[model samples]
Target: MNREMMKSLNLKYTKKREVILKILEQSNTPMTAEDIFTLTSKELHMSFSTVYRSLSALTEKNVIMKELRQDGKTYFQINSHNHKHHIICTVCGEVTPIDQCPLHELENKLTQQTGYQITGHNLEFCGICPKCSKQAHNK
Candidate 1:
């Protein structure tokens, strides 16, 4: 979490945001707002709207990233500075961060072929996870 993020949101360093950031930093996987709400409400007795508000602020400042799935639910995760993509499991919604950009070469080639300036891209690979595949086989 950066100081500027809080300042840009016109918010000070509150215990609420700190807790939220701590949770995100410690999590091994991305989590939905509902997941965070349930846990934080239990632990901090925070109001649902407050949690939502803080999440919105964090997201707006890019302190956190939001991924809206096909299910219409948005999952939130801490934003790392590295450029990364995700591979999602359609069966179980498991998401794995991909370190290597699959389209890096293609992007370079395209840049060479055309003079158009490329800024950014979003890439997601969807498939069944290993655990889901195993479960399907067992069934």
Candidate 2:
């Protein structure tokens, strides 16, 4: 999340989106629509349909990024241009951004070796989070 992105987000922010993005931005982990709906509804009176529609619009605008879980639920996070992927918790559904990219060198090499223009790529890593690991160990 850069300053420009934050500014742009604020510029185009709607009341619904503001609430949703605010929650995502503050969250240390990515959240599903149901999670967000529960959290947001607790703070303000909003319908699940509104949250779903807002999330759809935000994803379409590239303001927020979406990832699909194995359980068929969709999670969302702020769209940062820093080129990063996610490490998700299999148990608790937590998500953390991996700062370093595995494809950095590959992308550069591919661009140099071939004239084909590269746009972007998607990468995701899934595993148990620390909290879940601890819980499982205790159990």
Candidate 3:
């Protein structure tokens, strides 16, 4: 799949990029470059800069999406046409993707009223997750 995606993007497929893509594919949530680097480093000989470069290339080609979270760190995930939003745990920094997009109707209404095309949007909710809330209460 990585090879096919890279070929479609006209990117020269490399082992490093393949490894990075595999990592992202396996992840259930978006991950920071550092996280990717740490995981990739355990599997193969790769540098942080190389991971960054691969991420940048993949993101530029729309093979992956780059999201800037509240923590001011960028996260990467495989680009899927079934777009969704994320709810982030403020305390634990856990990001959970919301499968249902709540703004589709709003986006359609706004587009009709404003006479503009809505290409994309980003919406993130921040709050304490259940585990964190439990821990806080216990404390």
Candidate 4:
């Protein structure tokens, strides 16, 4: 978690929400709602619905990024100050961060072509990781 994210989270803080944020901050990769509930429920009392609703609120506030996987699961990660995207593994639901943004030229081009002042952009890349590719080949 970054300072900006902490400052920008405009929602009222609750025990469950604080627990969820701590879990996400400690996590290296994005996790699904079930994962959040399972990890925190052992120490805290929270329902699955409460976890999901908390996720929705956090995402709305941009405290976390909601990633939609090809496997039909939604994952959440802490929204770092760095602007980056993810490359997900379709086989095992792995998420890797891509440190570079490839939208600068494209956003400029589109702005000039369409005369629309583009404010921002989002891009997510998904494919089989090397391990998954090798596993598939061995099979």
Which candidate has the highest lDDT of all? 3
Pairs that collide in candidate 3 are none
Q: Write the per-residue lDDT of candidate 1 for residues 1-139, one digit (tens) a residue.
A: 6667677767677888888888888887778988888878756878878888988988887788887766678888888855568888998888898878899888888889997688656677889999999999999
Q: Which residue pairs in candidate 1 collide? A: none
Q: Which 10-residue window of candidate 3 scores lowest in summed lDDT?
A: 1-10
lDDT at 79, model 1: 80
Please, what are the lDDT tens digits per residue for candidate 4 over residues 45-129? 9999999999999898888888676677888988885556789888887778887888889989999999999865667788999
Worst 10 residues of 1 by lDDT: 1-10
The CA lDDT at 81 in model 4 is 52
Candidate 2, which segments miss by more than 4 Å at Cα?
Answer: 1-13, 112-116, 128-139
Off by more than 4 A, model 3: none
Write the candidate numbers in order of decreasing lDDT.
3, 4, 1, 2
lDDT of each: 0.81, 0.79, 0.89, 0.84
lDDT of 3: 0.89
Question: lDDT for model 2, on a 0 to 1 scale?
Answer: 0.79
Report the C-alpha lDDT of model 3 over 73-127, residue by residue, as the tens digit: 9989888756768899999988788988899999999999999999888888999
Cα RMSD to the true fold for all candidates: 2.7, 4.0, 1.4, 3.0
